[model samples]
Target chain A: MANADRIAGSDVFRPNLTGRHATGRFWQTAFLGATTVGILGLILLMLNIVNNAFGLVAYADGEDYLKYSPIPVEQLATSDLVVLLTNELSTGAINKLNAEQPLDTRSRSDLLALVFERILDREVVASSTLAEAVFNRQAFEADALAKNPDARFVFKSWVTTDFLTVPMSSQALFAGVRTAILGSLMLIGLTIAIALPIGTGAAIYLQEYADKSLINRIIETNIYNLAGVPSIVYGMLGLAVFVRVLEPLTSGAMFGATDTNGRTILSAALTMALLVLPVIIVNAQEALKAVPDSLRQAAYGVGATRWQTIWHHVLPQAIPGVLTGSILAVSRAIGETAPLIVIGASTFITADPSGPFSGFTALPIQIYNWTVQPQAEFRNLAGAAILVLLVLLLTLNASAIILRNRLSARRAN
Target chain B: MTQALSSLPVTDPQDRHVDWAARLRRKPRPVETVVQGLLFLCGAISILTTLGILLVLGNESLAFFTDPEVNVFEFFTGTHWQPQTGDFGVWPLVNATLMTSAIAMVVAMPLGIFAAIYLSEYAAPRAKAILKPTLEILAGIPTVVFGFFALTFITPLLRSIFGEDTVQIYNNASAGLVMGLMIVPLIASMSEDALSAVPRTLREGAYGLGATKLETTVQVVLPAALSGLVAAFIIGVSRAVGETMIVAIAAGATSQLTFNPFEAAETITGHIARISGGDLSYGSLDYTSLFALALTLFVITLGLNLVSRWLVNRFREQYD
Candidate 1:
């Protein structure tokens, strides 16, 4: 016991003197703190988007009734239902209600909007009070009397076929993404058509033909530079070249306009093609470069002509790579909005594009337009549109991944 | 056989040449020459496209420079970007672009480098496998989503913490922050490859000397991977410069040349976005100015990418 006390009382009782330990602890904590902050920032960003996009829906002051039910005609005992219906309907004449439903005074003005919304297309409602009676007594009365009123009852699915069918409207409840989707599809198709051949041809020439001269070195440098050029620069180029220089041809033949303001779908698509062309060419060249020289030599050893060797052997071997690059380029084109918007893609396109040169709106532009609206419903519409854009982008990316995997597997084999 | 050959050579010179030519035709030709030619042509065309892009951009910019309104000094120094008012100073836009890109580098470089170090030297195979793909998914997400995320989410969060006064409805910080997140995977992936390229023998030597793992990584591996790390940072900067939608949506378009991150400012590309949307006539100074801006952006980013390529190539050579 005395020895133990002596040992404890000796150097072991001295203050901790390992300065390195303290420094190590401090550094570790700092590193952990930084990493935690980064991850937290990412989480906070995602949660913020969800909160704004998914929280309680808000309706405009005058349009709040769209979520409620219409008044019941049966509650008006003595008065003629037809006269009462006409009187109640005229109250909000500016609301664009149909004359089909019989007058129901008990329903709030907001609930009446829903009744008119449901009956506007019904032909039987045009002549018969029965159409109004059924809707008025059941939906209008029940919705109006519910104790704890909710807006979800009138909630429209933003992912429905109608979302891709109907045109956009100021009424957030009726607004759909049909025009934007169509525009995006058209733009993607046009971009592929324009970018694929030029990009592929450039890759082919670079990998299959160029001499190892100073000129080739310069070209290589230039290609790298072009790839690094900002996308908005391409937008400016599109505005100048396609919209201005070729306006006579583009606007005249495609958009039926003579002025330079003819920012047709073709102009936007062409601009995007230019934006992604360098990417495709670079990727394609890399893929072509990966093809083994042994294969080319083997083909040549068989006394096959150069053209025949490349066509039958080298090209076939490089095709998977080229296709992979093309897929990536197309995906990039689909998500691009800045160049398109810069080249004058319409923000308020109502009709779906019918041809390559028609004026159109893209998904991103639609989201931007919706986000700027004064009403809360418009914000919801923007969220729904964003979801659509995300899904489309994912689909494109997935296909590219599948293609890349397949190519790699083939190469492995 | 010798006597016959001698007799044939004794005949007319033209007849002998014809006979030699026929024999040469019978022999198999070198088809590899043709294949080499084709490959050469492919390389040439790739070069041609690059030339075409430069020619197009250069010609348009030259046309823009001829206009008296586009004074180079004013464009580089002037603070206001009110193109409608004929005030075309590019300083404010440049400031915004530089400020956001700087902030993004600050956020991305350290985290990405650390993550790369962890993956290469510290993490198990299972952890690496899971982390790599998750990071790639982060990279693959569309920039539009990032923009939406910045505008809707990042901005509001900044508002709550710093108060609305500290952050604008559209501020540079949110855009820069999101951009950094977007680029982290890029830096991490590339830097990991660079760090892994360091010879294991060097690491083992450090261990033999009784150095700790952290010490070996910092003192040996990091220095060895310096060239590659620099390349990654430059590439990250190039990406930040070319980035459009995030800044356009999240960073406001005021064009005030101040250094304040809270202010709504325009970028060179952002100015192009604004001007291109207007009704500027073809060949007008405004329209031509867009091309000049494009050329400037092209030159800057191109320089950055070349430097990055050079560094990466050097790093590869050192080990190879």
Candidate 2:
């Protein structure tokens, strides 16, 4: 200690601490800039979506049917709404609607929507982005008025309850994501059903059953490679195997639908299942590996067979972990686009997919389709659809994450 | 369960232990045998998927290359890629893919590394708790959403900044920039793991010498995790190359060999999506060309992944 104290004297070489501390603080702030960039990217992405989703829309013609009605639009009864629609709509249009479904039988909201749909042919002539509407509304309105003197400018959110339930129309204002959302749900449900069991089985085989053989090694290594393969390649595989080689099965020819080809929900679902298989297997294997050796030893010590040990002890404990993996797989499958596009998602599908044999279009596919259209309103439609898709993914993921946290908390206990 | 157990045919209690041991030693029950076979089949399915991809791509690509209309030498060496005009140079598509990936790396590399350093070296526990899941959600967002941002948000902003003549409505810059954002979480998370895995003793040694936190982190820790960081970088580049939707949506359909980010050009993935999305006949030359492009993509990404895995394994051995 005396030698160190002597070395610390003014005669010895000195180190600069204050400057070094300043440098450290600067670097720390600089590192925080990284998080700031991430934050800005996220905020910008949301802002872009919001900018397109809600804006001032210039309608070329009547959306003022509310002024004609004596009651406030929201307070109008179903019969009153029907009467308003009857007064404004052509008898032919009313008859066609009645034939589709009686107006009296429709919900009040539905009747009100019909009033807008039938009485007021509200064709949006011009639109300004959310930013322009918010920041430069006077200028935007003046410009819009120059183009269409009679145009009624109303701030509108393109995404609404009516927009979600109705099928897409030729009119951008009337187009909805009903078919796309349904196709996505059906595809995801079927993909999980096919993938979860197969993936879990594969993981079990690799983790528990397979011995150290060359074939097992090959299979194990093959999965790692398959997981890295571009999803478009998987789509090519699906295009060949499911849509071509197995056309009779996927096209429902065996089920007496010989008129159609193999581009159906079944083929798409099978493709998605294959695409996510590796991810599910890898995750499930990680989950299985977390099960301690003692659990298996205890089961075997009691005269249980290998399968009995797996079923009674290991699998029960592994279920939560396995479920977490399935949720990841679900998310991947939901977000995947290129493969579905490659396997040929129908661009114009509107009919509700009735069976596996039905043609399909997912939410992503719908978004892609809408975004490519040359019209500004179509671009707005795409934005609204993107919001719907994000909401769907958010709900599913939120629930799954919550469930995972709960399971982990319980385990910690 | 007791009733089922009691229903089993039983011998005397004295003989039961031997019988039980014998049963345990016996070949698995039929149900067990069937289940094992099913599992083995499931395991092999991934292998079949790989083989299936190889077969389909190879077969159609073979047909395309062998056709009298195509010269294999020209396909590789040509400079132009108008499929209808009989010029089949793949370099344009390949070039666009590389250019966009290069642009993506430019945006992602520094931000990702810095984020990793912050998360591993400087973040408080409370900060991490929020930041981690937020990053995960960002990672989990669909690339199609990113595509929308590129088209509606980025393209306009670029146009406004650079002048309308300077930026194409559908340009590589927007797609690349948004894709960079999409990949930030991947690189950050992976590199953060590499940073975290650096042994603490080394940092402490540097600190013991009165070195600053930043100096210790930059000099002592980063060099140690260099291999893992490289692996993460390679993986990120591979992901950017394979990314399809953003390019398809924002990057224009023109297949040109140019380094300019403001100009639009089709990437290999984008070209494939564009051609396939059109109403080309089932057995057309264009249809087959997609498979060949897909084969190229697969090979590139596969090679990248193999290298990354190798590096990651080597990195793990150092610490483990």
Candidate 3:
């Protein structure tokens, strides 16, 4: 220690301290800036969607509804609303809607929304984004009044509880994502059901049973390559296979459907299942590979056969991992737009999917259709639907993450 | 239960034999063989899916080529892509796809690399755990949402800043920018893996020579991880090329042969989507054209993916 102190006092040589500090500081700032760019992009995305979801809308009820209503609009009873709609709408329009789905089976709110959209033709005269409504409220009111003198202004949220329950419509004010949500749920359910067992089985064969042969290597490589294939390619596969070649089954023609053909929930679900299969297999392989050999040895030591050991011990240990993987795949499938679009998901279907063979549209398709509309309010509707999709996606992801974490925590003990 | 079992008298040897026989009798004779066959079938499904994709794409694409109206030479060399009439030139669509992907790479590469450096080298463990998932969540967001964001939010911001004349209502720049954001996490996570994989001994060696932290990271670690970084970049490029919803919704669906990012241009994926959504009948030339475009996309992405996986494997081998 005395010798080191003596050498420090002598100060034989020194590095360029200031230049080094400056370089370190500069790099630190640069990296921090990069992280901020990503984080800011996420924040901006959320803000942009949230901002459009709420705003002031100036709506004008159809001329006939305004003239013939006996009482105020909001206070009208459900039966009275139905009668008003029946009286106001053309019989052809009412029949067409009923043929699509019976109006009597619809909820009261749905009926009311239908009354406004079909019979009353409630029109958005002028709409301001959330920012404009917040900062320039009086200006917006004046502009809206100038545009339509009789139009009533209201602070409306595009993403309401009612939004989740009502079906799609032409009028932006009455459009909802209930049908789309139901279709998405059905697709997710079918995808998980089809993909989980097949994917895990493949993983087990590759990890536990397969010998290092040429065919095995080829299959293994093919799985990796398929995982990187663009989603749109899978769409083409679905179109050709499920929608075309197997149309008799996918379209329910085998089950006696006469009109609908190929563009059914079954085709979309099958496509999504294939699209997520590689993902599930890859994840399951990783999870299965993580299991210690000692566990297998112990099972063998107890005179258990390979399948018995796998089913009783290894499979139980791998369940949480498999579930985590399935959840991730579900999230991917539910949000997938390209494949479903290619496989002919309807852009404007109002009827909920009643069976696997039923024609369907998903949330992403709904959002896409609304965004392309000429009406500014449809963009808000798109934003609202995006919020719904995000919430759904996050809830699924959160549950899976929480489950995986708890399982891993238990394993740590 | 353990105490009661221990307190019981030992069972007779014959009873144990009977129990073993009973268990053996109960076992299904064909269960294991059936399960193994089932697993083999499951594994074969992935291979069959690949063949099916190839067959489907090739079958329809050949049909598209053999049609009397579609000249094979014009399909590749011709610049215009007016499939509604008779012009099936794919170059314009390819050009637009490349332009959007190029812009996305421009936005993503530097930011992704630096973010990776920060996460791998600079972040404390707690910060890293939080930041990593946040980035992943950003990645997990549906691309359709990004399309709406690009159209409603970004284009307006650009218009206000650059004038309405410069930024169109639907242009490639907004879509490309948001697509870049969508892929930033992908690139960041992959590159972070590469950066963190650099041996600690190398960093220590540089530090021992009086090198600064920045000097060691940039000079020693980054150079060693270059192959992995290139792999990451290539993967990002492939992802940007295949991206559909953002370009379809935000970039106008007009098939214009222009190099301008500010102008409206349609990508190959966008063109397929727009065309397929129409009322074209089954077996029509227009509908068949969708398959041809998808074939092109499939081939391009497959090649890019092969190269990326090769590079990644090479990188891993080097470290191992």
Candidate 4:
């Protein structure tokens, strides 16, 4: 008994005591390092984006404008800016602009954008990445002035209210994510509309109706596999089926379509719906399965049919779960650009998506297009767009999480 | 099955004759049959979607192979890929795809496993709740954002560290690094589920044998959860392979069959995106080749997913 007691307490009984302890400590530190990396990466990513979104930019007005304007470009009001464009731009240029949309009919802001883009040809002469603009503003300003003596510097937050409202422009200063945001919203709405019912129905059938048969099992396996398929593959399907084969329907040609030859919001939305359907089905099935067998039996004991029991009891309980899952899936769909690119989502579109059949460009696609541009200012624009995208994603996810928690708490009570 | 059927009201022959209304009421409802049929139709649509994907891919891929310009033998054996120039070689794109995925796996696999271990074995409940959601938020960030981050932030940082000569402006390494960060949440969460699924009894036994927390976690728990860890790894690989935006935007769209991580190289997805984004005429060889590349990607991801599912099922049966 003494020996046993000694063995329990002794280092000898703890085989490889020093060795295991040392290794364990090493691993613990390693694990800590690994975990910290994720947090650090997130911090770095946010900082990087925020830094680019707000900074000092030096803008050089068109050399021709400098010749005509008595005052510096920065001091000019919106009205003066438009007047300057009319006087400075050649008659042919004005005619071309008028042909697209008459200057007089254009909104004040839109005319201003045109002035900056076509007449003034505003260019970012020199810019700093996020950090330099923040920490060494004097140095950045001096550098910008030296590079372009005529240019004016201003402190700007790229993600302003105006940035959210304006349409795309060749000029970095005038370009905005308005059209992209509208397209994304429309696409997401359509995706949810199409995917929700079918995914939920499939899940209900799998969990509540189907028995453990070979066919059911195969269906289950197929869904699991579908979820794993590369999203780009789905893009191919959309291109073929929705964009080409069913072009008349997708493009609304069958319903008096005018401009589009497929590659419409409807096609993109259907593709996204297909992309997210497996996720919804799998998640909905899990939520359905979580509903107790006892609950179903109790309903049956009261002479409720399977459909009635599911519709009245199981579905209500599972709604929150299904909703939360669908939100995350939609978030995934919103972020998806590759498949959209494959199916011919426009890289640059100024007009907001008017309807499901309208040609579109989403936030992710806009961000992608901007990132590829050689100009440094577009990167800043991409950063601002990224912030918008992140906000939209977080809001959706948070709402879903809150709803799920509340529902579950109520159920427990 | 009988137990499920037993709940419906039953009618005796004598009773039915005396009360015809009761007998008619006892019959199965038409609404039930209609609803079941509708639900079954819904389930069948998923199968149909898969078939559509396969048929679309297979049909176009066949067209691509049959095109005289697209040499099937050369597609696999050749090293260069220039669809416009009619080079038609696919291995260069394949190599780049592998290289990027390899770098991503290297970064994500160990970091993710260690993070999962820490979360499962060491993190406090509050910490777990906070950290898990935080990780999920990371996952929720759009891939486009990551692509931009890779381009503006990661690439510049890498250039500063390694000097301008080694790190090109649009290098695969930077893209791969950001892609890894994008995938870390996926790997960690899946791995956490696997690690947490390890039975407490096994852990306790290890402790009883005078093992330290680290020893039990590393040796006993990890081994017990090996299949799950493997599944997580496979899933990670699939995600890395399927990723598009990061490579398309940040990584170079130029195709080269080089092993260097810092060099500009195009991936299969990137190649397809670049070509497809342009105005390619319908029925062009370039158009069909896009489908061929997509088919390859689909098959690879599909195979990985199946293996992952099989492994998960195998381990689950053992434990249950």
Best by lDDT: 3
Give the per-residue lDDT digits (tens) of candidate 4, residues A333-385: 98999888888988888887889999999999999899899887898898899
Which ranges in model 3 have alpha carbons more than 4 Å from their true place?
Answer: A1-15, A64-66, A77-79, A89-114, A402-413, B1-29, B317-320
Tens digit of per-residue lDDT, candidate 1, span B1-320: 24534554555755645665565346555665654555555445545545555776788778877677777778777777776788877778778999889988998998788778767877689867866676665676567667777777778778999998788898898889888988887898889899999999889999887566767788998999988899999989998987887887788877887787877787777677766766667677777777777777878888899899888776663643
For A113-215, candidate 2 gives per-residue lDDT tens digits of 6665556665777877788889999998888789888887889898998889987677777789999999999999999999999999999999999999999
Error of 1 at A272 (Å): 2.2
lDDT of candidate 3 over A1-413, digit per residue (tens): 99766654664433456667888999899997998899999999999998888899999976555576866666787777777777878899889878866777776777777777766678999877899889999998998889888888889999998888878888788779999999999989998999999999999999889999998899899998898888888988998899999999999999998789898999988888889999999889888988888999999776677788889878878877888789889888878898888888999888889999999999999999998896789988998999999999988888888988898788678
Selected candidate, larger DockQ, 1 vs 4: 4
Note the residue pairs that clash in candidate 2.
none
**Residue-wise lDDT of candidate 1 within A321-360, one digit each (tens)?**
8887887787778777778867888887676787766788
Candidate 2 or 1, higher DockQ: 2
CAPRI level of candidate 1: acceptable
> Model 4, which residues run further than 4 Å from truth?
A5-16, A63-115, A402-413, B1-28
Model 2 lDDT tens row, B1-320 = 34644766677665645665565456448978988999999998988888888899999999899878889898888879999988888999999999889989898888888989998999999998788777767788889889988998899989999999999999999999988998899999999999999989889999998678999999999999998899889989999999999999999999999889999999999998888776767667888888888999999999999999888886663654
In candidate 3 chain B, what residue range of length 10 has the lowest lDDT sum? B1-10
What TM-score, to 2 decimals, does candidate 4 have? 0.92
RMSD of 4: 3.8
| Candidate 3's TM-score | 0.92
Question: What proportion of the real contacts between chains A and B does each prediction keep?
Answer: 0.44, 0.71, 0.72, 0.80
